[model samples]
Target: MARVGRYDSRTIDKIYTHVTKKMDDNILDLLDNL
Candidate 1:
């Protein structure tokens, strides 16, 4: 159970980072367009 939890946490962290980066990229694109 601990291992599973650790894996889940890592996966979630990576996903969060990826999402934030994508969001940042999107914002930059919008700013450029504007």
Candidate 2:
């Protein structure tokens, strides 16, 4: 049970990092356009 929880958390962290990075890129693009 503990191992499964750890694995799930790791997966979630990866997804969160990916989403945040994409958002940062989009924000930068908008700023550049302005």
lDDT of the candidates, in the order given: 0.86, 0.86
Per-residue error for 5 in candidate 1, Å, reads: 6.5
Clashes of 2: 0
Give the alpha carbon lDDT tens digit for every residue of 1-34 in model 1: 3655647776878888999999999999999999
Among all candidates shown, the one with the greatest TM-score:
2
The clash count of every prediction, one per candidate, is: 0, 0
Candidate 1: residue pairs that collide: none
Q: For candidate 2, write residues 1-34 as lDDT tens digits.
A: 3655656776888888999999999999999999
Residue 24, candidate 1: alpha-carbon lDDT: 100
- Which TM-score value belongs to model 1? 0.70
Candidate 1 regions off by >4 Å?
1-7
Cα RMSDs, all models: 3.8, 3.9
